[model samples]
Target: MRDYDEITAFLGEWGPYQKSVFFFLSLSVFPNGFCGLSIVFVGDIPEHRCFIPGNLNLSEAWMNRTIPLEQDKDKLQYSKCRRYRLDVIKNLSEIFPDPDSVNISEVGQEPCLDGWVYSKEQYISTIVSEWDLVCNNEWKGPFAMSIFFIGVLTGSFISGQLSDRFGRKLILYGTMGVQSVFSVLQIFSPNWELFCLLNFFVGLGQISNYVAAFVLGSELLGKSTRAIFGILGVCISFAIGYMTLPFVAYFIRNWRILLFTLSLSGLIYIPMWWFVPESPRWLLVKGKAKEAEAIFRHIAKKNGVTPPEVFFTDLELEDLKAKSKQSSTIIDLFKSPNIRAITIVNFLLWMIITSIYNGLSLNTSNLHGDDYLNCFFAGAIEVPAYIASWIFIQRFPRRLSLTGILFLGGVVFFFIQLIPSNLSIIATVLVMIGKFAVSCALAMVYVYTVELYPTIVRNMGIGTSTMASRLGSIISPYIFYLGIYYEFLPFILIGCVLILAASLVLLLPETINIPLPEMIDQMQKFKFISRRDHMNLDPLYTHAATEEDNTVTQKTEEI
Candidate 1:
């Protein structure tokens, strides 16, 4: 029976219909770029110290000494949490009217009971400043970010199931609405607790819409266009959206105003539903052939082409229906040794990639130099990385390409710690390089993982791998929080993990020039074989040159 692509060949790739689907669907992902990482600026910690009220009649020098100097990282800096006792300073100020003559070194330090005074030079307000999520409460900032990823973890488990059952376009738009509405509601959150709660919903909707759009594009676009649409179309659009964040955030420093502005932009995408149709392939799979036919005709009309009088033959419809009913549970993933080994490798690879990618992205604020430029460059480098990955996947061996990139990223991160603190720009450049390597590695891993799994359990494999990624992302913020303990702790940790990830990639068989494994027994487990040898082992595979040669020899002898 003909597959959906073979049957729809008449529609042509890159026709007017394909172009519109690519454009609108890619645009749908634009908000996700910023939505996922908005916490970078939203929760930024500005320069702050314990507030010293103006009522203190102390001299300027004494007032400057209010925040006691202490060891932070490598140097002595004004303490963020502790201050010289103001009452003691007031008494000393009275005894010695000459502030220069007074010795207040031993005045004793206390916690900031008077709240904090945040520097407004960079940002007028952020979540950190608005609610004093600094010093002792600094953990809350990263915790909030983790809470968002936890919601993403929750969404990863259920969004795909919902999309499979309810259809792609429905879940796509439904989640988009969830993300935008919750973002707006977050602006009115009166306290940190409510804001964090809203963040969970925002994270849930964010990943749901992104994944739905991805699957929708994969199904709706034709074969020739799907590759580029997946790489350049969707990925670059997201990068463009990410690049826009720093600019928007640069202008609007206040967290509330930033959410308001970004939320309204998301709301504008709601009207896109009028033009975008549900995926025809999904409809056909669900036994709604009539509806799928109507959508095909609509697409043909939009592309200015004529559709065949009959869209789906009865046999083709039955094939699709049968395909839909064939299901594999998660247990199948662990049932076979080869399948289990491949699944385990993919899980680690995905977790490593996701955690480092998000860790570097969120840690951009901690990098030396302007926070906005660091973030902007971090996003900008990915566009090229994604494009390079698309090219690499087409030409390079999958295993080598992934290993090389991951290793390079790990080395780049390691080099960051060696750079002197004064050379902030150099360090930032290395971080960008690290980001580029991981972004490229991530793109390759997605394609490589798809090829490694058999068709029956492919969805389950990818879904489980995605869940691992969410867990990685969930832990990423906490890893970034380690920077507080030592400035380069996170980098050193990420570098070690990425290096381990690179080493692990050597265990997976290369998929380049190799046909996808269609059954559990066909997978390579942990070793590679000659293409002919690999194909000859799978009874279901007939595309091998050896098979064709054997057929020719038999036919000639018979003749």
Candidate 2:
């Protein structure tokens, strides 16, 4: 087998033990994965809050607005859409400014309320009429989630660029500082619009920590260790998000306090900035000769190895750049089809995985499973999924494993629909398995995605894939909110969507034995396969290579 690229030379220089600590330190980013789940876990949520208009008396308003929205045809549908938005925006009240809170009209578009955020939910557009939120008529929860992920989607890509252009350390520290400010606003927010606005900034600011932490972990471990380490890092984040969230929700019951406290705690991780090394690859990518040199020396010092100063010179970086050893951009992904295909498939998988993970996990509390044991049961499922991935990911083909798990997830969900409501425990267990499979699929996607494309655009591939996942995460809230009333339909549809996603995978290429190509040029040899076996790429290459050798032997015999 070919050795890992010398570009990964930083690993040999750092050795094994230091690798462990760096990997451990990287765990600090666990919070980023949990942030959305954290902010949404308010007690006031699930049980939608009654944010009655001050002008309308509570009992009278319930008679005119609440009951009417439920029973009347045209009015009920409009009111349900109105309530869903209000439900989401009011949840944003955790961060919105008081007195200045966004009124109903502002949520949809008109901004009837002076400070209200105009809601723009799209996923639940079909059944938004059934639910009820005591907030204004304009609140659009899915749209609100879209706004938050707008921050995440835009922020994640931007931070990735800035990290490559500047340095991961500086970007990480800067984002943490800004995020701290935004989190504080959760306490003071009087209006829903401002809350959405603040979440945008927070999403933008917090993603750097995620980018830098993963980069740091990959740099610390050897290439062989990369998959397991990265997957575990992801599992750690989800498990923590699942486990700790209920406590935070139970204690802080008030989403605002929970948000403020968590945001403020982010600053505590900032000091680790002193110990976290700048990424040697990033430094090499940017041509920062001296900075790269110093960081390399520190890593060598930690590993008890001698530093090579000769490689840190200006001429060396420029040479590395010429040799095609530097990093690249997202636009580079579309420069070739191999990267493009993997990227498209990976993006779709991410979208489905994130939506399923968020849709199921975030709302587990809503399933009448909110007690101590039930909550424990919920948090406990993610770990095994991680264990299962570690076993099957390498042993089985990506096509088989991915499709099987997702298809099974959907099937399980479908079965849950068949079980009666009285079978709560059995149904919850089955749904937990579904959630577990979805989370595992998400983690595996992270590992599989990295190797599917060429190196020039690896980060771009992952970033774009993540951008799609954020789209899924954004879409999930509406899916769950809409399904609350049409309970079986949502579960059944989520299953069907996941099944559709699994089918998409069946149509893509499998990367198991096909060595990860370092550039688009290497893909030329593998492109002529029949479409039926598109994903059956590994064996085709071996067979073709043997046939070529035999042809060469025939010419020799003729001569």
Candidate 3:
């Protein structure tokens, strides 16, 4: 058993190749958020109407009052609308001076409705009722977000049961296959209701990338690499937004075409699937002793090492004693000690995170788009956050560093409220700071949750947590819908929710530099540490690389 544990420890010690695969895979899942933002890219900014019945030249006031809104109907009815219309024509370039302005902004939104503009939709009634195909906004707005996250929540919860019954790798492949099909379908949806429905189904399939990818990676790796891989996986997954967002913002004229084209990138994994090993731990639990042994032997042989036959025999001896008590079902999770608490906290953290992440990304409308230039600049800021978090994560303990990141996100979001768009430089800086902190918070929460759970209920815990995360996701669109009505509403709500999430994190124990928490009780054994020494992993982490992981690295190195 000791040797088996020793050999099992370093199964993926070579490098970050598997981490790389996971990172790339994460992109297929998260780019939907980026796409959500870009959905409003070519649409018009809406103008508010006061509906007063006096002598004010509504058109003149509209043109010279602020920025010219893409659509203005409520102001058109004013009795003195003539003089107001003339001033707008004089400065047409700045405020719809020419006839072609509407044609130019009509990229994805077709037909060019004569009196409508695009903006956020924080109201549920408006999102469900008003902004369908009759409007250029389409059904793919907040409702699409709700549908996608619903799929994520359900997939996250169910993937655990599937893995528990079958195995990890199989479930992973199955989920990805389904997600690819649905993602492609989402792009071509023609109507508002149909598009919303397709987005819901697509979200369902895409979320599988999250649940299965993380568990599959964690099962194959040693503890030392797990946290790093987990965090990096999330960052790289989202970074696709930086590259893809710019491309979509620039070249992809139609939203559906961009989605369909991006869907093809997922196929890159099909060939790579030849190498990902199934979870030996899961096999062991199923009493597939010979199968587990063969895997172990193969790993040992590949590492220039050998597993003694005794290790296999000992691991196979089912602890009949432990087995006699009760068969461990997924349901045992709800009733377990301390695990229930962890599950609740984990779920809430994901919810708050997904809410803010998806919400803010879609809020790109509020950001500048004089050209696609802003998209590139906004996306570029993510890299620095990744590097900064990379340096601090393994060094700083999860509690303080993670809380700081989340709190920082909330602080930046809060400041965004104070700084108006007119103060362009300050607003831009604040947005960058907010994005950086939120990204770090997102990476830490996902990695930390994975580390806190034990192997027995690992998948279940993650799935349940993601379910809560999905709930947060569902609410994001509604919040965004409200922001459309009241410009700062969503930002204010997201900032406050994020602050609550940051506070909630402090209640959970830290898991850096500590041994992998096996049973729930071991979680109570946490100790705080200084920032500098966080990356020093335990000896168990570098045992020996498994054949599956080692095989891929050797081939890559040779090539």
Candidate 4:
């Protein structure tokens, strides 16, 4: 029986239908880039000090001096959390008409009971300022971010199963609705607690829709298109979305308005349900051969080509049905030694990549520069990283590309610590470079992990890997907090982690110029199969769209 690609060759690789699917799907991912990392601005904590109420009847200079100056690193700055005893200050103001005459240093300090005053120079309003998530409650800001990621974790865990059970299009649009509706609800959030709760659903919808789009695109597009869609198309669209955050956040300084604006973008994708069809590959795997063939015929019609009346051979349809009935679960990922090794390595790599990526992205506020510009630079850097990743995946082996970029990222991170503290620009450049490399590695890891799993459990494997990454994201805010102990601690920690992750990449087998495995055993067999042997034994091995694909139309079916 002919393979799916062989049977579907009449539709053409870059047909009119494929182009539309690619365009719509890539556009759909644009929101994910910004929505995933909006916390940079949404949860921004600007320069703040105790709010000295006007009822205290204090002079301007004494009022300004109400908050005690505390030693921060090498310089003295106004304390963010503490202020001099208000009653004592009021009494002192009566005794010493001249504020300079009093011993301000001797005054005792207390927490800001009246609440805190946040600077509006950067943000007109953020969750931090709106909720007074400063001082003792400052941890709440990070906790809010973590709650969103926890929602991502939940989404990642269940999205695959949901997608597999329901059709991809159903889950894709359903989660898109989930993301859009909940995000709008957050605009009416009366308290931080409610906002965090709504944010969980936002995160749930966010990653679920993203993963759905990813899987749907992978299944809908042809072999070559899959790689490009996964690497350049989806990733670059996300990066573009990410870059928009700084621009939008720069204009709308209020977090609520910014979120409302970003959340509404998901609604634009509602029309995609009519344009994008269910994944034919998924339908075939689910034993809906007739439904899959109807989609193929529709694509052919759109592309102005006539498909064969008999789209799939009876034997091919039977093969699909047999495979469909053989269900695989998460337990199967660990049932075999080789598959288990792949699963474990994937989990660790995804965790490290996600934690480090999120750590670097989230810490932009701490970098020595303007937060908006820093964020813009952070998002802008991803474009080239993704472009470079596309080129690497096209030219180099998966393992080499992932390991090389990760090593380069790790080394650059280490150099960041060695830079002079005075050269903030140099340090910032290094951080961007580190972001570039890690961002590239992230793209590579996504493609690599996809290729590592067989079709039977591909969604499960990707979902579990994504779940592991959320664990990393859950702790990433704390990783950035490590900077409080030492300025370079986050970078130092990321560097060490990336170096180790790079070393681990060597253990996994490469998947370049190889057909996607159809079963878990086929993936495990990769370790023992030489490249030349792969081509000789499996005619479909050159599924990367080589010239051989034109002539090798039919081959013996085996796994």
Q: What C-alpha lDDT, on a 0 to 100 scale, does residue 200 get in candidate 2?
A: 82
Total clashes in model 2, counting residue pairs 3 or more apart in sequence or in different chains = 23
The total number of steric clashes, by the backbone 3 Å criterion, in model 3 comes to 13
**What TM-score do all the candidates reach, one by one?**
0.93, 0.75, 0.71, 0.91
Off by over 4 Å in 2: 1-24, 43-142, 308-318, 323-332, 335-340, 371-376, 524-559
Error of 4 at 496 (Å): 0.9
- Where is model 1 more than 4 Å wrong at Cα? 73-75, 528-559
- What candidate 3 gets wrong by more than 4 Å, as runs, is 9-12, 15-140, 297-311, 320-343, 370-373, 451-458, 513-516, 525-559
Better of 1 and 4 by TM-score: 1
Q: What lDDT does the true structure give each of the candidates?
A: 0.85, 0.61, 0.59, 0.85
Better of 2 and 4 by lDDT: 4
Model 4: ten consecutive residues of lowest lDDT: 550-559
Model 4 over residues 1-559: C-alpha lDDT tens digits? Answer: 6777888888999998899999999998998887778888889898899999998889998888898888887789999999999999999999998889988989888899999888988788988999999878988988998999999999998898899888899999999899889989998999999999998999999999998998899888898788889878898899899888888888898888998998878877978888999998888878888898899989999999988878777777788787677665788777666677778889999999998888888888888888889988999999999889988988998888899999999999889888886888999999999999999999989889888887767877888899999999888888877777897888898899999999989888878766767655456333444433333223212235446532332221221
- State how far residue 164 of model 2 sits from its true place (Å): 0.7
Q: What lDDT is reached at residue 410 by model 4?
A: 92
Better of 2 and 4 by TM-score: 4
Please, what are the lDDT tens digits per residue for candidate 2 over residues 30-106?
56655655544432233222233554323332223321124431233333222324344435454543423434334
Q: Ten consecutive residues with minimal summed lDDT in candidate 1?
A: 534-543
Relative to the true structure, candidate 4 reaches a TM of 0.91
Clashes of each: 0, 23, 13, 0
